[model samples]
Target: MPQKDYVKTARPKPKAKPRASNARRGNARPTQGANRPWLLIIITALLLGSFGWFLWYLKQQPANPQQPPAEVSKSKPVVDDLPVKPVAEPYQYIKELENKEVQVEVDTTEREPQGPFQMQCGSFRQAEQAEAMRAQIAFAGFASAVRRTEGTNGIWYRVVLGPYDSKRQATADRNRLQQQNINGCRIWNWT
Candidate 1:
């Protein structure tokens, strides 16, 4: 068996050199002048300078023009402004009776005074409700007690504050209780 020889090769062609253009090879094709950021910068600076000058000018101006002072009266008015008539007193007899006392005989049929002031903090048909209100009043720092009484209407449980003799003292206590958010409290004169 004979071996065959595979040898004869073809010659390769040379690559052509790329020709440079006159514009690219430093032939002074006017280079687009260094991108003009300076113009934008100068414009911005001028705008800022103008804005500062405007603010300075505004600050230099006066807020208002000068004005003359207001004239004031030197003397009081001559005519009286009040009405000529005097007010009538409501209870002149009570004022007159302040110092003097006159005694006269009267029947003893009138009921005797039981207490000073009778305060009804709550009036409820339900005894439990009245009792609850009484407890609430006591918790809120007022001396409260529940009392049941029968009347023509029906039986009612009343939360009583005090049997104060003086109405003024009772009124003061009522006001204090009211300030503490206690509602439906009233002073009564029970004989």
Candidate 2:
């Protein structure tokens, strides 16, 4: 094993050339999409200018020869199919009663006035339905009242039983209503 000398060798690295400036590169390739912002601005300006020109052109053009306003018929088209029925005049007694003042008897001793508990049989949006329910209550031999209440949605017709003198009476009325197979009867307080 003889001694061996190790020599250090140096390697040279290649130098990178300077990059072209954006301005020079822009001039070299005029159609290159490098300046996208400028292209977008130019396109937008053209669009806005055309729109403004269109509006100005419209203003310069003479107002379309004012055509005569369309004639609107004052009368409605009527279809005369059924014969007209005559309306009955009011009873003569009503006019006589309107001018007369009559005396009435007081009977407050029978019992305290009815309480506020009322039995609501049904609520309906349609007048016909409410009327039908009222008729049904009449047929059932019970006096019912229709209350028209306006709410956010629309008018509501509520068919309700009397505000009985006590809760017991109201409960009894509800039971009677249920026996007749009439469901959805709910008690409500007037207060």
Candidate 3:
């Protein structure tokens, strides 16, 4: 038995082709028209619309010009010149006015004791300071007096203004104290 020999074969090469021209292949110019006419038409339409709007604005404006306001006339008041007469009195006479009134003797009774309302301004540690403030208040034409009272902490000397019947009067007095440049003075209702 003999082995047969195998040989390799070479194939023929392909030739290079030439490039085609665009003009001969009908690919040079554009088939569609230019867009300048459409743009011009849009611009013309916008201009016509704006012109119509301006015409409508001119028609909406008032035709007559504005005029100034008229002046108002003030007339003088007329009064009567006749002599005035007095009218009759409403109350002329009273019958048995003194006889009908009852005559009774007035009783002079003694007045009851009145309790004063005490307003506490502040508690001072020193009695001298309280006394000094009391003196100042007294000198200011106020009937002021100082009283010593015992508190839970210690003894307190209270400077009181008066037994003012009303809180309004007491507040007025307090304001007067403030006007006098007196600090640490406040209104207190002491009943």
- Number of backbone collisions per candidate, in order? 3, 0, 2
- Deviation from native of the Cα of residue 182 in model 3, angstroms: 1.1
Q: Give candidate 2's error at residue 6 in angstroms.
A: 99
lDDT of 1 by residue, 113-157 (tens): 556778888889998898888888887788888888999999999
- What's the lDDT for all of these models? 0.82, 0.83, 0.73
Q: For this target, which candidate reaches the highest lDDT against the unseen true structure? A: 2
Displacement of residue 188 (Cα, Å) in model 2 is: 1.0
- Which scores greater on TM-score, model 1 or model 2? 1
**Ranking under lDDT, best-scoring first?**
2, 1, 3
Which regions of candidate 3 fall more than 4 Å away from where they truly are? 1-116
Greater-TM-score candidate between 2 and 3: 2
Instruction: Indicate the residue-level lDDT of 127 in model 1.
Output: 88
Candidate 2 lDDT by residue in tens digits, 35-74: 5788889999999999999999999977765785656677
Alpha carbon lDDT at 35, candidate 3:
36
Ranking of models by TM-score? 1, 2, 3
TM-score of each: 0.42, 0.39, 0.38
Candidate 3 lDDT by residue in tens digits, 34-151: 6367878999999999999999999997776596564656785565899877696556445456457677998899766354555555566789988888878776767777788898
Flag the better candidate by lDDT, 1 or 3: 1
